[model samples]
Target: MSIIVQNISKSYNKAKAVEAITFEVKEGELFGLIGPDGAGKTTIFRILTTLLLANEGSAIVAGFDVIKDYKAIRDSVGYMPGKFSLYQDLSVEENLTFFATIFGTTIEENYDLIKDIYIQIEPFKTRRAGVLSGGMKQKLALCCALIHKPKVLFLDEPTTGVDPVSRKEFWEMLKRLQQKGITILVSTPYMDEAALCDRIALLQKGSILKIDSPENIIKNYDKVIYDVRTQNMHQLILDLKNYPSQYSVYAFGEYIHYIDKSAGFNPKDLAAYLEKNKHSEIEINISRPTIEDVFMDL
Candidate 1:
């Protein structure tokens, strides 16, 4: 295992931040911690990177104990915090050099590791990091984290505020990095991005709901799903919740995805019933389960 977290737990002033979380990341795997804000993804990343010690259990990264080999772990792991933390006043190249120097290395020494990513923003090397655009800042932060050529990279919501194109570009860069034998552990709240990972852990309220590859996770969905679209979407949602024979219902994009309590429930009958209730332009269709749907079901 490139990363192993065994029953790790962390608390703050008697409140549990992470409760006995356990997961493993294989070498060269792009593992994702998928969850919404305040789901303890940051806490787990901190503990794994040795920034904070766990109150219970243990964690090992790249064969080094997080606590006992704190320095070693620090040297072997590259961490990009959720917030951009590079020096604002420093130029792009200056910030990269500073981080390299702190790690007892030089930008030239490990230039190849981040060369591809850095070159994209090289024209802006002289620009102050503070004045750079959000996408540029994100790339600079990633390049700095990778300057030392760490074995494992922990990216905490690296695409949070980036543009969609930049987000897609970033994932492509990560795919190339993984090809070079770097284990990547990334966390994001975006369900769409979850499908890009080799495996994902769905977290909610500081607890893991499920862990598996995206395909397997969706394939394992045991409920029948239906997409119901009507002219009165808002009112349709309200009506569906109160409708008989509903297992669960929630608004999904332009349609409301619902699950019936029993397999025998007839879709036509349900539509007819809604039409009788004065619902117009009602269209209902069965759809494949998505990661978002699975999250809701969980």
Candidate 2:
């Protein structure tokens, strides 16, 4: 395993950030910690990267213990924090060089590692890091993280504020890096992005709900969801929640995803009930389960 976290727990002033959290990442695999904000993803990242100690449990990163071998782990892994932390006063080239220098290496030594990503920003190499656009800054941050060619890379919500095109490009770059045997552990709130990873851990609150390939996660979900919508979206949700057979009810995009608790439930009965309630243009159809659906169910 490239990363191993066993029963890790952390808290601040008696409030638990994560409790008994556990997972592993295979070498050369692209793994994701999939969840929304405040799901303890960042706390796990900080623990695994040795920035903060867990209140309980152990973790290993890149073949070294996170605590006893903190220095080695720091050297062996590249960390790109959720917030941009690069020197804003430095130009793009300067930032890359500075990171490379800190790692006791040079740009020429690892040019091949960052060539693809760096090329996108090389034309603006003279611009200060603070003034670059979000997408450009993202690429530069990634290049800086990879300048050392570490065995493992930790990206915490790397695409949170990025545009759709840049987010797509960033994931593609990660796929290329994984091909070179760099283990990647990334966290993201965007459920759609979970499908891109080789495997993902679904986290909520401070616990892991499920961990498997995106296909398996969806395939194993034992729920038949229905997409229900009407003229009034808010009222539609309230009505569905009040339905006696409702197992779960929540808004999904333009529709309300509803799961029935009754064994012999029928959509016709639901439509009849809605019609009686004065709802018009009722549309209810069997919908495919997705990562978000599974998370919401959990």
Candidate 3:
């Protein structure tokens, strides 16, 4: 494994941030920590990258212990923090050069590693990092991180605040990097992006709800979810939640995704109930389970 975390725990003051958290990432694999904001994803990344000490637990990254070999781990992994942290006053080329020089390398040494991503922003290489657009800054940050060609890469919410097109492009770049044998551990709040990972660990409230290939996690979900909508969505949700047999009720895109506690759940029964409640244009249909649905259920 390229990364191994066992029973890791951390806290701020007396409040627990993460408790007994554990997971691993294989060499040359693209692994993801999928969760929403405040789910402790950043804390885990900090621990593995040796930036923060865990209150309890052990972690090894790139064949070195996080504590005893902190320096080694720092050199062996490339980390792009959740927030942009590159030298803002410096031009793009300057930022990249600074990172490479600090790592005892140069752009020419690892041009091939970051060529795909760098070229997109090479046209803006003369612009100051602080003035670049969000997507451009993202590309610049990634280029700086890869300038040293580290064996492992850690990206924390790399796509957050990025445009849809740029987000898609970024993931494509990651897929290419994984093909080059770079183990990547990325965290994201977007459930749609989680499907792009080779494997994902679904996390919530500082605990892992499930860990597996995205397909397997969805395939093994035992509940049947229904996509339901009515003319009055707000009232429909309240009514559904109050229903005795309802297991879960939450908004999902154009409809409310509802699951029942009983196996004998019938959509007709629900429609009838809604009709009696004065709801019009009721629509309820069996919906395919998605990563988001599974996360919400867990």
Candidate 4:
């Protein structure tokens, strides 16, 4: 394992942020921590990168203990925080150069490591870090983190506010990086992005719900799901929640995903039930389980 965490826990003042957390990331693998906000992903990142200490348990990164070998871990791992933490006053090139220099290396030495991503914003290299667009800033941040050519990389929600095009490009860059044997651990709130990782740990409120390959997670989902929509979405949810057959009901995109407690559920019965509730254009269809469904089920 490139990264090993065993029953790690952290607390702020009195409230616990992450509790009894444990997971591992293999060398050259892309592992994702998937969940919504306040899930303790950032807290775990801080602990693993040696920026913060855990009240209990232990963590090892790149063959070094987080507590006993923090300096070595810092030298061997690249960390891109959830929020942009680079010098905002520095230009893109200047920021990259500064990081490379501080690491006792020149940009030319690690040019190949960041060539693909840096090229995207090379024209804006002279632009101040604070003034660049969200996507450009993300690319520059990634470049700066990779400038040191570390063995392990930790990216904290790197594409949260980025555009779709840039987000796609960013994942592509990660795929390329893995080829060079750099282990990557990333966290994101978007359930859709879970599929991009080699394996993912579904996190919520500081607890891990599941950890497996994306396909395996979906395959293990035992519920028969349905995509349901009605003329009045709000009323439809209320009626469904009260329905005796409902196992779970949650909004997904333009429709609501419904799982019934009854195995022999019939669509016609649901349609009729909605009609009685004064809902129009009621639509219900069998649907596949997604990463979000897996998270919600747990």
- Taking all chains together, each candidate's TM-score versus the true structure is 0.98, 0.98, 0.99, 0.98
> Alpha-carbon error at 175 in model 4, in Å?
0.6
The lDDT of each candidate is 0.94, 0.95, 0.95, 0.93
lDDT of 3 at 52: 99
Query: How do the residues 196-272 of candidate 3 rate in per-residue lDDT, one tens digit apiece?
Result: 99999999888999999999999999999999999999999999998889999999998999999998888999999
**Cα misplacement distance, residue 89 of candidate 3 (Å):** 0.7
Give the worst 10-residue stretch by lDDT in candidate 4. 263-272
lDDT of 4 by residue, 218-254 (tens): 9988889999999899988899998888999999999
For model 4, the superposed segments whose C-alpha errors exceed 4 Å read none
How much lDDT does candidate 2 score?
0.95
Query: Over all chains combined, what TM-score does candidate 1 have?
Result: 0.98
| Native-to-model Cα distance after best TM-score fit, residue 206 in candidate 3, in Å | 1.4
Q: Which is better, 2 or 4, measured by lDDT?
A: 2
Over 49-153, each residue of candidate 2 has an lDDT whose tens digit, in order, gives 999999999999999999999999989999999999999999999999999999999999999999999999999999999999999999999999999999999
Model 3 CA lDDT for position 226: 95
Q: Where does model 2 exceed 4 Å of error?
A: none
